[model samples]
Target chain A: MIELYLFLFIMLIAAVIATEIKDLLAAVISLGAVGFSVAIMFILVQAPDLAIVQIVVEILTIVIFVAVVFRTTHIDETIGKRFASTHILSMVLFSLFAFLFLAAVVQSLRELPRFGYATMRVASEYIRLGLSECGGANIVADVILDFRALDTLGEATVLFTSVIGVLALMRKIGRKR
Target chain B: MRGMSLVVKVVTNIVVGFIFIYGVYIILHGHLTPGGGFAGGVIIAGALVLRILAFGVEPVSEKRAEERASAFESLGALLFIGIAFAGLIIGGAFFLNFLPQGTPLRLLSGGIIPLCNIAIGIKVGAGLFTIFLALAAIKYVMED
Candidate 1:
């Protein structure tokens, strides 16, 4: 819809403004807002899981930024130079490529088979049988924990590694002192 | 540094408390709701950050929070692995749900899911909190 496009346009403008801002703290806050806006769009498109992940990651990133900013100068003097003519040229090229890719995707969608109905039917059937056969109360949870346990395990391992990495970084800082 | 306004302190504390409570609720009801462990954990960490912002870093006590979070992180990882091992001992596949299936779409249902959510919540909350504390520690160190 026109409204959706308009909203996206506004968000893009906000993102650029945020990045161009002179104040580092304000820029970080604006970037967080941009992330939230993208999360909202994701939810509007019926991707609640993705939206939640985006919001969480963005919040963490903002926290990290705040921590960094506390140690650094607030004024960002490089913004103007960073967005020079060469940078603008590269950005234009990047945008062109992205636009082309999106156009191709939209065009392909018209020719794609209408599998939404079939997918829903299969999912509903799975929900019914999965409960009885698998003896799991929540079908989605069953699929995630039982059927795709390996994926869950891998994700958990990644989280564990990141935790260790953080600890190690902190210890290194302590050692330096 | 100048003292903070009373209103700001009160509002920040209230918001932080709300975030913490909501995080716990989300983690507990993960199976029946949209929120899960990661989301809940991040919300809890956000609350910690809010506290840090309202109160100064010195008042927030990074050392104490780090100790607790590190312990929680280790415990969570151990518990998660232990649960998976329990499934193996029960002659089911790894991470299998050996418990009886209660009524669908109800609380206390999804045996392993609830347990997993709890483990994940602890792991993520502690992990994220540790990261924040570490970053704050870096700032403090650099200042000195």
Candidate 2:
């Protein structure tokens, strides 16, 4: 649609402007704006979860940059050298890679089975019988907490490991001081 | 540093308060809403950054705040693990929702999920706050 094209055009312009901006702080703000725009696009594409994650990550990244900039006032010196030739080359390569990957994903999307069919045949039957077997009220909850409990356990373990890692790092820093 | 006009100080205070309140709202409504622990926590951290920038770290008592944040981080992690272990002790699998599911689509309905969100919010907020403080401390030490 015309609106989508307009949005894409604006995003492209914003991306170029962000990259071209001489001031590091301005560039960072512009990049954040572009990220927000992309997040909106993700929402429009029916990926609300991904959109939220993207926006959150973008905000964190922007805050980190702002903190760094405040501590170090000389932004011009921090802006690394910009080479036109390498930029173009890399851009082309990146575009090609993205195009190929997107093509594969689109192919997969077409080939994938519809969730409704599987749900009706496999999941629904299991759910109908699950109350008698699992003693859970909700079928979906039963599937997630009971049938796939191992996966949930693994995820919890991963969170535990990361928290431990963070603690260890903090302690190590404390000892160094 | 103390020579700043009253207008600037008032404006900065209002802005900082707004950011902090917004962050808390996001964290509290995370389970039923779009915003979650990480987003809300980062927003809170941003408010701290703004406060530090407007009123320098010295005025804010950054070191003491850093210590408090570290304690909060530890408590958050502990609370998260404790919730998980509670399920195991209740004869259910790990991380199981032991409490009654009051009603779906309600804020208080998702028993463990809301608790998990709170724990995550605390962990993220404190973790980020600590990192910022540590980084600032490094700069402070180097300058001194």
Report the C-alpha lDDT of model 1 over A1-177, residue by residue, as the tens digit.
565576698788879888789999998988887888888887776657568768988987987787678657799998767778899899999999999999999999887667435444656677667666544554555666656666877788898898788778766444654
Best prediction by DockQ = 1
Q: Write the per-residue lDDT of candidate 2 for residues A25-62, one digit (tens) a residue.
A: 88788888888888887777665645765886787788
Query: TM-scores across all candidates?
Result: 0.80, 0.68
**Per-residue C-alpha lDDT of model 2 across residues B1-144, encoded as one tens digit per residue:** 122357766788889889888888777766455665656777787777666656666724766877788788778777777777888899576876677655555556555656665776687777777776666665555543
Give the per-residue lDDT of model 1 (tens digit) for B62-107.
Answer: 6777878889988887877888898899966798777766776777
Interface RMSD for all numbered candidates: 2.2, 5.7
TM-score of chain B of each: 0.89, 0.87
Error (Å) of candidate 2 at residue A107 is 5.8
